[model samples]
Target: MECSDARMLLVVLMIVVAGSRQASCNVVQFIFGDSLSDVGNNMYLTRSLARPSLPWYGIDFGNGLPNGRFSNGRTVADIIGDKIGLPRPLAFLDPSLNEDIILESGVNYASGGGGILNETGGLFLQRFSLYKQIELFRGTQELIRNKIGAEATDKFFQQSFYIVALGSNDFINNYLLPVYRDSWKYSDDGFNEYLMMTLEQQLKLLHGLGARRLIVFGLGPMGCIPLQRVLTSSGDCQEKTNNLAINFNKAAEKLLQDLSGNLPNTSFRFGDAYDMVNDVISNPDKYGFDNSDSPCCTIGRIRPSLTCIPVSRLCKDRSKYVFWDEYHPSDRANELIADEIIRKLGLSQLNTTNSFSQSTAPSPAPFS
Candidate 1:
């Protein structure tokens, strides 16, 4: 061939290869952690706290199945899934949903009793720990590879997003639950550092296994949870407990940013859950919330025993409240929060095809 023809052919080949790589980056989302984003993952498992069979859990979802979600309706994860244009995440343990469904958008590995550490308290029996959850994800991916053949699965791996929404249970169970205080034996700094070490290790492991992007959520205001309010103190929030969450979040933020810098073609980001919860709490009216201090559920005339759903009196207007129960938010509230997160990560308005553009949409409300 002529030299000029050879040069032109090489240029065409390069363009085709680049186009192929971009096409392969089809978005995959994997969710992990506790009740906050549990969806119905906990329901498939045999557990008393499971909510997949109850009222108010899927009031907005049309199908009306509780699906084990711990809210009066859809949780934040559902909203996020919608915003990203994916179906609701399938619970990893759901027997009804096959691996085909689980492998599509992704699988939700979150469990109600999950925690950062194995010994963290108050989790339901047979729940997977954060470490164990990662293992499940790894195993699922491998199963996908075997089912679809390695080449197709490799493309799925590269374009996927992994979300880790955890750490709250670690603080609540290990520190707040009475049963764990004597067993875990962690001082404040000791606990924080230990959790960080586990988190760092987990991120590295995921990265090694082909996770290209991750969003690790920081703990919210633990002291403000209705359950914590009922058990640890009066209506007043415990500043010390909230402070622990803040410390952990700040540290994780720094760690993730550093990890992104060191790793090529890999991004690790922090989800500012702490600020989002605080915003709703500090200025309830701004987000159409009338009460952020107390849950909308009915409580006993004396000490509380149950959440504000099914058996409890639900607020006349769930949108007016920040929390639906002790640890979950109403669907509207979750949609708003998901909007903020989508804006923060610039994940809004994905492309019609598998490609995405930098969102030109107006930024949502500032998180207080």
Candidate 2:
């Protein structure tokens, strides 16, 4: 381990040992990731692609209206929050976010098309990188410190669960695209090493900034997504792409384990969405998914449209489908993904805080 990694971990331990704020029963959540977990951060970015601004995108949400979520209802983050009985963390870009709201439920910095690498989603024109998301959280911490105190803010963060769902876009959007120089700049092995090195710095950055309980989500089988499948003549999952995902997940899982062993009072767990998601595709019936190949919503007679637009053809039954569009999973699949991650990885960090109790009254949203 690097000296800096140890120093960062030391800071976290120091904060915990000296914290005065009483631990609350509620476990606040700070989420960071890509489109799979995006609640609507992309909607605010006018130039970003993959914006679900049309009918049926969010028809099943609590209010039966689109609220920035990409699925028919909730993202994996939403389902996980619901299962834990915690309020959904509001988007960091939401106009009404304030310190009190963050202190209560935390914030979501995940954006549509986001990736671990800063350049991973450049084609999208607008998205938050893992580094930028952490910066936003740092800003949140500063505001909370001013409102409360540094020690109190540190204590609050010490017991909170930090969930990160990224990586897929680093491969799908950047490494694979000829438009991005990453393809020629690094060989397959070199690219993997680059990503690992970058992720290590990012994970350390979060810890140095006061995060203790961190969950880094691994990449699933990108070869199995509807878009990837359609690219092949056989319409089959690309084993080459699957290999990339598997290799990256292995490296990531090791990084998480190494960090956790060296960092005291910190739980660095890996959310292995790869294995379970691969299983779902291999055995659709086992997960109540009948169609795991083609997406539920699509356009085009031969090669399907790259994204789910407002005028895409809708499936008769969305629940039975594994994917919502060419690139993202269905609401049902996201629910299962959340269940698998929580059950297998074990969110013991969430137990650090008794609860993130709900407010008795509505919270007034504050502008950033």
lDDT (Cα) of model 2: 0.81
Error of 1 at 270 (Å): 0.6
Candidate 1: worst-modelled 10 consecutive residues by lDDT? 359-368
Give lDDT for model 1. Answer: 0.71
List candidate 1 segments past 4 Å from native.
1-25, 48-52, 181-184, 232-234, 306-310, 351-368
lDDT per residue for candidate 1 within 1-368, as digits (tens), equals 99999999999999988656534434657888788788766666665453445665664454555657776666666666666765556788877655566555578888876888877634456567888888998898788787767777777776777888888878876665668762357778887888888888888888877888788877778887776676654577888889989999998999899889988788899877568768888888887778887776555445464444446665666667677777776666776777777877787533244221232122222112
What TM-score does candidate 1 reach? 0.83
Superposed model 2: Cα runs more than 4 Å off:
1-25, 300-302, 348-368
User: Candidate 2's residue-wise lDDT over 1-368, tens digit each?
Assistant: 99999999999988876443333446688999998888878888889876777766776665556778777767887777766666678889898898878877889999988888999998888899999999988898899889777777788888777888888898889998888999889988899999999998998888887789788877888999998998888999999889999999899989999998887777888888788899999999998878999888777555576566756777777788899888888878888888898898664334333233332111212112
| lDDT, candidate 1, at 128 | 74
Candidate 2 lDDT score at position 166: 89
RMSD of 1: 7.0
Q: What are the clashing pairs of model 2? A: 25-354, 25-355, 26-354, 26-355, 26-356, 27-355, 27-356, 96-366
**Model 2, residue 244: displacement in angstroms?**
0.7
Residues forming the 10-long window of minimal summed lDDT in candidate 2: 359-368
The CA lDDT of each predicted structure is 0.71, 0.81
Candidates' TM-scores?
0.83, 0.87
